[model samples]
Target chain A: MADESGVLVLGDSTGGELSSMSRELLTAGRKAADDLGEELAIGLLGATLDQPSQQAISYGADKVYAVTHPQLAQYQVDLYLAAMEALCRDVSPRIVLIGRTNEGRELAPRLAFRLGVGLAQDCLEISVDAGSKTLLANRPVYGGNAIAVVRCNYTPQIAAIRPKVYEPLEPDSSRQGQVVSFPVELDPSQARSQVVNVVEEAAEGVKLEDARVVVSGGRGLGGPEPFKDLETLANLLGGAVGASRAAVDSGWVPSSYQVGLTGKTITPEVYITVAISGASQHMAGCSGAKVIVAINKDAESNIFKEARYGVVGDWEQVVPAFTEAVRELTQS
Target chain B: MPVSIAVLAKQVIDPEMPMAAFRIDADAKAVVPPSNIPPVVNGFDENAVEAALQIKDSQEASITVISTGTSFALDVMKKPLSMGADELVLLQDDAFENSIDSFFTAQLLAAAIRKLGGFDLIICGRQASDWDNAQVPLGVAEILGLSCISLGKKVEIKDGKVSVERITNDGYEVVEAPLPALVTVSNELGQPRYPTLRGIMAATRKQPTIWSSADLDADASQLEPRITLQELFVPVRDQQCEIIEGDDAADAGRQLALKLREAKLI
Candidate 1:
């Protein structure tokens, strides 16, 4: 082997199954490994690992390093960071990919700082230069107003890929790979944050990313009352309601309603935006949708440019009619 | 014992600026601020400040705001003070121009934190609006060996530990950490309190304690950038939209719904 240098995917799990973000990271990891002609290894932290390890392999990992410990079951910066640092030191991989999940948002920077290397956060694309073997990435900046291409100067370069940017590889059950229980001596005393309880917002139980259709509103909605109209339409269409950053910032809606670069990233079958001017940041979160339908008053609004179908009209008059039509069409 | 809290805030170009006015200075490898609009405190940083103010509201605590940058808008940076922060500290220096690298920024901020010791907690925004790196708070925690928590919408201090209602993909989880921890807050904390006229007058009467790179213990070599910016530009899009037309706005709305039904989008 040229060296112990390869791509390592920092895998995560939810409810014992492989997390979607982890699967997507494997996609990016597999790409770099293929380009570099090196093994694609995944590092997963948990109390149990047999199933998640195999799942990672089925998603294209050639090897799985399960960093196992009793306290490692959940994510804590003090404990998880220690284990990841130990794992990185042992594997000595050339590239590390972390999903920009809640955990990754915290871990990637700390990991990069701990390793004394560099990180490109919230990257939408990553590639390795063939000649120099340098890792490069395209990341959105200025709230996704622009894109910046960055390069890492130090070894074991790290990146936290934005979720939904890369599609997950289809699982191949017959695909065989090796898994090793990479043990770490975790100190419970060193840990700081303790998870008391995980409570799901009941109203948001219908996840936006999982929805087939999403009807979203923005500043043009005027106030929170209009969101009820959007909710009516979404329910009629069997979808969810989303809000632009403006609406969320205006206190017209909770931030959970927001969908943008800083908010949530959703890839639905159909995205319907109402009275929303599509900012690049907002588009970044929903551009992957199969079809985008925009309803706005401004004909010159940017949402039209990214949408497949659009209506230029006041949302007040348009939304109610749209809801009625959706109800009639679905009822019949 | 009264708790000592440090809130880290940054002044950034108004993210609310019209997209058409957003520009990239390829020659400088930086974003060119729109001349007509003034920079404001980053949106998320205001949330962090709100988190601190909420804690202060319930307990006997002192809030000290800190910011490290090449320069800052005095009024903008003082918004935290007007919102109830007891004191302000500005780590303004040319050396921070290398803040493009989170490592440098972290080292400098950590050094300043160390110099202003006795802080039981450090709160920062989940990420800044400009670079959107979301790295400095975690980096500072790493450099200072502090316990770190991210994406907290609700934060409180009790039983000698800080507990945060952390935002997750599905919902939120209640997390507790011991003192000397770092917490990053997001917009879910709700809008920051508006500065009252009386508070504004008091803030106007107050002056911030300023520090430079030389005031900290960090060395020159420790601030070298690990990441390099190769290029900066706006992404291009070319999707041509089909405008649905009808007799009136209401008709167009119906037509749009019918269009979606035809495309099997629903």
Candidate 2:
């Protein structure tokens, strides 16, 4: 079903690992297509398409425009944006959705500007109005306290959706897709950025963004050493370790694990904050957590107000009890 | 040559308030306003101001601050101008309250910047706090047709091209592009500077250049929303917290272990 405004989903495959974000985009795109009564087309831009193209179909893309170029092997903004502009011009999509990963965060705005349209970034949810065919994009605003519904009056209403905000449907390996080869021409010398290396995270169990249970630590833990207990609990539960901006700025954890307005936004089943004094900045990252447990020495800490369960005790004593109790319960 | 840089900033509700203070209208897909919402410069845009200051710190440059909102919102956006800005542009309009979307927001700023002229660089936070769509920089870059870099954590200008270190989960990617490009700053870019007393005095006396939609030369049709937000709602939070029943310390461990296993973990 094609309408006045078509849908184009964009994905970037780095070193053969189709970004989890790309998969999430496909999921959202598939749903948007069904709701809008439009065909979903995907643009896979990279140096190669061997593994990613297949994954795109499994995730739910009907047609894939694969552009393989030597210069594209590296994620160059100019090259990629230029290619995307060309693709959008050819397809004339009413809505262009990209993942809020590093590339999408940068590219969508540029693409929207080039097309002279409106663009929404890092949206949590997007839907199309049946009669008007207008896209209603919902995203966190003012940290995480408020959400704004954005509508683009212009054509090619482009947007970047955050990863993990939406759940992906089970992949059907049998799903087939049409592969349209897009020939990309680029000058190697024209690109300013070169991919010197790719460093992957070595964490096991659940990825940070996709984690169900998140165990977070803050400055109240006193030092970085105490977080070992928190990490142990997270690992045992097959979850991820998150940190407050205080802990990250204190060098207790890498900035990657930081959760706050300036850090990663997560929505987990359970979030346990150890020795953390709740600040608006820190809480912004974890407000979406379903269950919050705060263990702190300060009885009047603001974290208690946000916590489902509050333990007004030392972290050293509480973390061990919580961990040991879980250990025994699981063992039984 | 040092580039002229302009930053568009906005005041947004603090998102990390307690549930008691916030409410979500799930059906409307919008968050209900809490009475105690504190104002702050949108997170990503602070990095933009810092990026502009960095360019000024390294070379001879003029950085201006532009904001679109109520006069009361001035305190939220003016801090950066005092920290180290050469000028300030304010587009205060009542319609701006509902027109926070990046498209029109960009149009408002682009009109002012275009009128100012002689700008070699533009910096914006990836997104505003209230909108958090991260679209303005790319939109402004596109409207101007200059190259654009988003999530730039580190930036340097040399030989008419700006080199930037963009932060990614994998690490940082270094890219260089020609001048007259737009760069959106990442949180890791650097800490924003506090305004000095002398700088504060200057900002107090400084008259921000004001422009209306008429002055901007923007199409009224383009200003009209393509998408309409019918309603706003806040999400409801429900948590089921259960305490483990046990006697001795070791026994408590057993109870906790049982719960973990019940959740399918060893």
Candidate 3:
């Protein structure tokens, strides 16, 4: 499949499956490709293909390319960049999409710099300019205080899309697509950095990103002890516990629990904020939530402005009562 | 020989400013600076300085702080020095004003680093607060052919290599890169150290070295901007929060839960 001049999603199959972010990229890619009247191709690079090639097709990829190399087993910036640069050059896709993920945050920039093109990072939306057929990206800046619409002046424009902003298409198992093996030579020695150990701090139930309900706390929670109450509420609702950057910076919670522009971007069905001031940066992470609930002593908090439901009260007085009520309701 | 470290910091509009003060001059396609508050060094960049200073705390390392912009508030730019960095270098020019192009910013910074060579490590913030490009450091590493490890919550130099506890979604990975590498730090690294009176006094005595495109043999005329801003505006929120009222705080809590349940949100 030498079909070029279309959209290419630099999909990630880190866990031997299509990542949710990768799937989100497809939904965004499909929209952009459809708008531009171009084909959408998805590329996966790793030592082992996650069988996500078929998964990519089901998600909306018209063509799938798996670029594999021994050195590509894990995300080593040098090898991934080399393989991806080679893949882009060979396919010459007009526009490329990468998830604004932890690895993608590094990979996208390096790849763009390598390709000698421009990349709009952490974009909330990617639109097609009909007349120019170029990619226009809207990204949050100044800690999500404002949104800037940006355009790539050169071909092979790149974008790192924030996860949770776009929903993935439901998979159709009956869909059929061919997986092309694009060969990219990579020498393991070319890798400049190596990961010697990985520590898993989040080894419990209800991953933050996958949670439907999220109860978050902030500096106003006073100390780490209050997190237990939030966790209790989250557990009752079968949700996850989150934190504001202030909480994380205060060492009351781990960085993994932080929700903000510089932290994790999550979209839950029911997002409850406890005592958070709702900085625009914090709002950037949870704005995609279907509904927001803010509980703060100060009614003027920016979070209430973005929330669907709110209460003006001290978290110490309100949270336990809310938790008890949620528990009672869930038990019934 | 003392290990040489280059720390890249940026001064940006305060990210902590109130939402109401965040106004975009639509006609200018720029954010209007709030008059009440002044700009500060990017928070993550402060983390980078702390990371470098931590290395200095344990080992013999000379830290040189570099910042590029159309202008500088010298006092804010000298923050790293006050925090115990050895030297300060400012890359300022008229062309750098309202610079949204991360690639060009990286190019100029890379040129400055090249002009002041012999550095074993380069440290920068994960991203700037204004543009949030998160590209300049990595772009510089790409141009300099240096190994780059990003989002380091804990950075240490050992065995003549940079070891970083790189933050991942669920946890962190211990990544190691050889010398002459680049690393970007985040807030997870911990609060940067407060500038001591002694350190601040020393910083007052030391003068910053200023450089422009002319000072460094970097080409700027031929380069095209990597990103062009089409529009800048505050995103509107259509949410109308129903503030659940009650006689007391606990009653309000109970009422809010019932409201959510009534709305089928719970």
Candidate 4:
């Protein structure tokens, strides 16, 4: 008999490779499944998901469901929704976990709505409630000022977990699991919105999320020119350049580089914030950094309160000298 | 025929509330509304209204603003009206109090839209500032079975088709969809315009059409929230500061670099 009680994880893939976030979800799902004394299942939806399905099992999924079709190559909201909804109705899992990526954020809500269930988005933590045998999702709210623990009263509890919050388990190559191929019929005419083109922004160096060291600037930089200096510092440290929402809104940098509640959450080893008065919103994203360094002309800036090290000085005078010193130190 | 559009708006706690004053009651599992800070229209929802207004400015169109909440302050509800929306439809009922997740919220809003009859387009914020779920627009689109374009930074309508610049993880994609579709506007659309004095005066004379759960024949039990708040708490940060001493600005920079190197950060 098909397992009626299991934790179902949605595996998202891009460019024919399983996303790291999907792996993290599997790790989290494994823990939740262990707690509930249930099985862990993963669902991969795309055109050709053979490799990803095997990878899901290796990461700890006991069973993998691969839903494939020609129209499923690129993510179409309606198409993915229909396939997942069908799979959920057939399997009837107790909990559904999805990554809070662009695709996951778009899919989780619609799936929950279709199933007449509740969804918690961008959750920081997920755990099983021992008493009710339900899932508890902890998420940041009020622009990251507070945390709320929420539980789904209905079955098939759904949640969208944030990337990097949970660590993925090391894949065991020898692990074996069942792979089920579920085929679904998709009508091309049903898709109203089609992706015309996906243009990747020409990014240099490491991505903000993966960077070990991050050098971020704020409105205090005055203009976009000073960001080049921050980039130089980031390059010298082998890190990536980030920005505050103000700087991005000021047209100094692209939204991709923004670090805050509305932007990307980064947990680098060292976070150097320059010319940025630390707003609670910006700090919410980078608070997990091991060390925070603030450089601003204002000694009383809010950033200093949150920083482990504070330097009261103009960024123009401090950043260049700091960049040169780092170059020399790294060279030695 | 002139284009008819419905822009979804929401009233939320002030996002700009200072951190020092922000508080949550763990016992109540609710955010304690800071007495000084009053609830306002969600910033992104206003951006959705702005997107609608821009379209109305270029062509002959009618814009109706809609919201679903238990008790919406009139001042907050009138914001879009004061910003040039032709009508406001509010779904307010005791049945919607304290519960109703985004799914049910969308279902109720969709029912109201259907009752409104003719609408060529529906626009909403990518997400609300409070829950930050970014789900309702997609949920509404799903319930209505309409083409949905999300994270739209730029939207335009011409000849029964909509063109949008949709924000993606990498960058953005230019997408086109047919009429009667829903688009979730992002902050990239730019700041919503402030209401003019004339617009505010005109709004004073307009009364919003209020509907209860019974009005839409919504199943009361189906409207119950799927997710329940278990607990609310403030996160504590434990860190101590170490000021990097220097002779001057450049010296401080040097000292900071040396300290980072000693810590094996660079």
Rank by DockQ, highest first.
Answer: 3, 4, 1, 2
Residue A321 miss distance in model 4 (angstroms):
2.1
Q: Judge candidate 4 against the unseen true structure and give its global Cα lDDT, from 0 to 1.
A: 0.85
**Highest lDDT against the true fold, candidate:** 3
Question: Which ranges of candidate 4 are over 4 A from the true structure?
Answer: A1-3, A298-302, B98-100
Q: Extract clashing residue pairs from model 1.
A: none
- What is candidate 3's CA lDDT for residue A110? 96
lDDT of the candidates, in the order given: 0.87, 0.73, 0.89, 0.85
The docking quality of candidate 3, as DockQ, is 0.85
Task: Pick the winner on DockQ between candidates 3 and 4.
Answer: 3
Q: Tens-digit lDDT track for model 3 on A180-232?
A: 98878878788889999999887278999889999999989989999988888
User: How are the candidates ranked when ordered by lDDT, highest leading?
Assistant: 3, 1, 4, 2
Cα lDDT of model 3 by residue, B92-168, tens digit: 88877756789888888888999997489999999998988899999999988999999999999998999999998
Measured against the true structure, the TM-scores of the candidates, in listed sequence, are: 0.95, 0.84, 0.97, 0.95
lDDT digits (tens) for residues B1-266 of candidate 4:
78999999888888887767777788877777789888998988998999999999999999999998889889879989999999999899876653426767877888898889948999999888777778888888878878888888889997689889887755788888998899998777888899999999999999999998888955677667787887878887666668887998999999999998888777
Summarize candidate 4's per-residue lDDT along A85-133 as a digit string, tens digits.
8889888999999987777767888788888888988898999976678
Clashing pairs in 3: none
Candidate 1 C-alpha lDDT tens digits along A128-234: 88678788999988877788899887878899999988989989999989998899997799877888999865245356877888989998888889888888888
Across B93-130, the per-residue lDDT of candidate 2 in tens digits comes to 66765444667777777777788884787887766656
In terms of TM-score, how similar is model 2 to the real structure? 0.84
Native contacts recovered, in order, as a fraction for each? 0.86, 0.41, 0.87, 0.78
Model 1 Cα shift for residue A258 (angstroms): 2.4
